[model samples]
Target: MNANLKGAAMMVAAMAGFAVEDMLLKSAARDVPVGLILMIFGALGTVWFAALAKSRGDRLLNRDLLHPVVGAKSLAEIVGRLFFVLALALAPLSTVSALLQATPLVVVAGAALFFGERVGWRRWSAIAIGFAGVLIVLRPGVDLGWGSVAALLGMLGFALRDLATRGAPKSLSNMVLGVYGFLALVPAGAIMLAVTGGAGVPPAAALGLIATASVVGTGAYYALTSAMRLGEVAVVTPFRYTRLVFALILAALVFGERPDLLTLLGSAVIVGSGVYTLLRSRRETQTAAAQEI
Candidate 1:
């Protein structure tokens, strides 16, 4: 397959993996503290990725790890994962996942601002409409809560991480990046656990769930990093919308979550805006190419 196609496929797989990981983490949270789950989950993923790197004869301690972009990505990862896990634990799955759908919109806008990528008025309008959808999902005065706020912050953090990922050193392997990504979760979880002051021996079932989530999450992280590197960000990013579908289905089936009309409508709006942004980006790219030709 072509690079864009491969990237799109990898993105879809990553979204599916992430959906499953969220489900598992949410399930485990019922039995274990959210902070504890994050710590264990991050530690397991870190070990797995570190081992993968070692087996491949790749150095885990590359100087590129100290790159400013990598540091920024690491901090973003911590913020994203920390708050997202909290949202999953405290909020309805459907709501948290719906808010998460706004990530690409944030990333597109961030690209324009931070990387000096050109974003025309049309794409800018789409971004505005997309964030308006976020407000629809939030329904500010009606149902705004800490969970909703956490989900929004988490989405922003993840968006920033994606933007930083685009500038990460090419010398670093995906596995190596995965190691650092998961490693960041360690301190994130520890900080939360320390503040919340709850760490206990999780039940065996919770341990099993956390372990499975770590493995799935590790794979998802790999796929995500690979997808970002494989093709144009705009081409691969729309597939991220698929996560909402997966999350909605899983939420309904597993958690008995039936999202309200506003939530569904807001999700549709967000997805529509995101798709439009992608089409606009592709059209611009094609026009630029044809002009060059």
Candidate 2:
């Protein structure tokens, strides 16, 4: 199969796995502490990735993983995972997922600022409008609260994580990055657990849920990395939107959430703007390539 198609399929599967992971964690939140859930997920993911790396004869802990840029990436990951998990526990899953669609827009702005990438006025305008869409979803001054703010913070954290990933040394394999990403979660979970102590021996069911989420989340990470590496990024990246579809379905079926019209409109705007930004960036790359040719 062609690379784009392969990547698209991988992206879809990866998103499905992620959706399942979120659903499982959300369900377990009823009986398990969010911090404990994160702790278990992080520990299991670290072990999974570490073992996979070792099997390939890669170092379990590379000094390069602690490089400044990677350290920043780890910090972003901690923030992103911690807030996103908390948002899941406290907010509507579909709404939180929709808000996360703004990450690409945030990433675009972040790149221009931190990475010295030149973004044209048009893209900047789009980013502005995209954030406006986020505000619409948030409905500040009307339905505004900590949950909405937490979701936005989670989006920005994820945006920072992605932006930092751009500066990661190419010598480090995806497996190595994966291991470190999960490893950072160890400290993140501990900090959260310290603040929100609900620690106890989890029941068998909670343990099972945690194990299932860890395995599925680990697989999703691998699949996402594979998809990005294997296909044209523009093709694969758009498929990330499928996560919203999966999330909305799960929310409706599992949580009985029927998003209001404004929420749906806001989601549409976020997706449209993000896709436009990515496609425009891809066009710029192509134009630059042709000039080089």
What TM-score, over all chains together, does every model reach?
A: 0.91, 0.95
RMSD of each: 2.4, 1.4
lDDT of 1 by residue, 170-276 (tens): 98876788789888888778888889887778999989999999888778877987898897887897888899999999999999999999999999999999899
The sequence of per-residue lDDT tens digits that candidate 2 reaches over residues 40-74 is 88889889988878877887666787689998988
Which lDDT values do the candidates have, in the order given? 0.89, 0.87
> Which parts of model 2 are misplaced by more than 4 Å?
none
The collision pairs in model 1 are none
**Which pairs of residues collide in model 2?**
none
For model 1, the superposed segments whose C-alpha errors exceed 4 Å read 1-10, 54-58, 223-236
In terms of lDDT, the best-performing candidate is: 1
lDDT for 98 (candidate 2): 90
Error of 2 at 130 (Å): 1.3
